[model samples]
Target: MTAARANTGIRRAPVQRRSRERVQRILDAASELIVEDGLTALSTRTIAERARVPVASLYQYFADKDEILLALVKRDTAEMDAAVDAAVGALSTVSVRTMVAATMRAFLTIYHQRPAFVVIWWRGRSNQVVYDFCRAHNKRIAADLFAFAQAMGMAQDGTVQGVVELAVEVGDRVFQLAFEHDLRGDELVIAEGIELVIGYLERHATPAGIAGVSVQGQDGPA
Candidate 1:
């Protein structure tokens, strides 16, 4: 996928510093608009105007509004996974509860930081395209977790990946429920979600030495 995502069809990679700055500006403006007006209100022209860039400039990097939104979603998810990778990797050893708690805290932190993403992801689920992108993101998170689990000495049995994927799907739903009525997320639901994930993984994950995705250059854990 391109930095903006394959689904986004970003026109260029923004190799230059100026281009990168402009791209960030566009994303920031889109975020503000989304937070204020919701996804249904997005358009290249409006984003450009809000960003104070030409519409042509916005299209230079993003194909359309969905692309812009997907890029924003991508940034937030990357940070979320990176946070999890750092949190667990810093530990000398990881218990199931510790790992699950780290993952939940990492994601919740990102969700709170990116209110626009919270709006788009939770409130915009009725939009099929947005939902598809998010589902893909969930699968990616599952894949990353699978790698991390293997590194952590969880058995390499065939069931591990499948189990991890299922766990991620369930966790994603629980997170959605937590954020459904409250953008900051319901504290009770958040706490229960942690317990639920830890409980499921307790039977599945075995403790071992800590490792991080950043160290493995791309195939590492989350």
Candidate 2:
């Protein structure tokens, strides 16, 4: 069956377990197709066929191909957010270097686990919705980093937020380069990215004075 919904490209939120699973299968099929054949080969009919569901069932969840892609973007971004939050939370206190390493490692792990992320990120540059989502995601990450820096007494007087934004921007560029050269990511480039972020943070986020203590000198405060 052809998509009967309007061209607005909205998704019908699944409320039941079976429905959610079906929606997931549809998204999985789309992701696999995108990775195997590129975005140009993705279509609602192909996704439905791959998912072993009827075209109508696919429409029940996604209005069209774009809707399906948007849903995938949201799901992937949520997973990334969870990973980053877990990595940040694992550290009771953090230095600039430790924070950079932890966050980069978390992201690289996700990129490795979810190959679809590479497609989504690359497409984000040309897709307005995906682009906006990425920008928002970066802001949230920066905000989280800012809070972590404050908690660790490493935020500079007026540069914590900007520093965090720069770190995110630079990390994104380097990671993109790494993935461009090697799907899983280039180990050498990933290491360089970590160092690049650490250096930038060091320049902007000075250790907050606390008597014979240094944020950069230790893993964290004793």
Candidate 3:
């Protein structure tokens, strides 16, 4: 997806360097507020105050608090996606176990770096637009991972979309629970999540079908 398409929150895109800096400040202030005071306390006026800009300045970029929060959500999602993409790209050969570890680590790293992400994500779910955006984003990532598996000759010529989607769902739930219990994420839970994903992939993703070999049914590898 295009950058313009991915960023769906801002009222207007910043063009000049000064305008961009102001927008960044607004977003930074919003993030800090969410981290410090929780999502309930976030407001455009407060964000403007923290950002050292007028409320009008904030309105120039974001339509409302929800918009700012959505922008933050998109920003954090993009960073996490970039990290995962980079990690996956570096793998010359794909092993389900290795991919699971790399993806889990990459996600954890982002959570550590941006604790506010937890707050934004939790709050964003309440908004329909944000929820739909997140769902679409997840689907896109799953498709990309499926393509990666195909490129590595790991996935057979069949529909494994559900497998990738399941991986994402499992990862999100497990990671969210980890963060809910501990800021750094629970090590035991993360390890178990990795195993869960690897086991699922091993059972679902089969080698490319050849003349002599029969592909496994949905029940599992035969």
- Per-candidate TM vs. native? 0.84, 0.85, 0.86
Candidate whose lDDT is highest: 1
TM-score of 1: 0.84
Query: lDDT at 192 for candidate 1?
Result: 88
lDDT of 3 at 205: 59
**Per-residue alpha-carbon lDDT of candidate 1 for residues 29-86, written as tens digits (9 for 90 to 100):** 9999988887788888999999999998888898778778777887887788788777
Local distance difference test scores for all models: 0.75, 0.73, 0.74
Model 1: C-alpha RMSD to truth?
4.4
- Kindly list the per-residue Cα lDDT of model 3 for residues 116-149, writing each as its tens digit: 7876664335666667777787788778777666
Worst 10 residues of 1 by lDDT: 209-218
Off by over 4 Å in 1: 1-9, 127-129, 155-158, 206-222
User: What would you estimate as the lDDT of candidate 2?
Assistant: 0.73
Worst 10 residues of 3 by lDDT: 213-222
- Pairs of residues at least 3 apart in sequence or in different chains that clash in candidate 3: none
State the lDDT of candidate 2 residue by residue for 17-86, as single tens digits. Answer: 9998898898889889887877777789999999999999887777777777767777787787777767
TM-score of candidate 2 to 2 decimals: 0.85
- Deviation in Å, model 3, residue 138 alpha carbon: 0.9
Residue 197 lDDT (model 3): 79
Clash pairs, candidate 1, are none
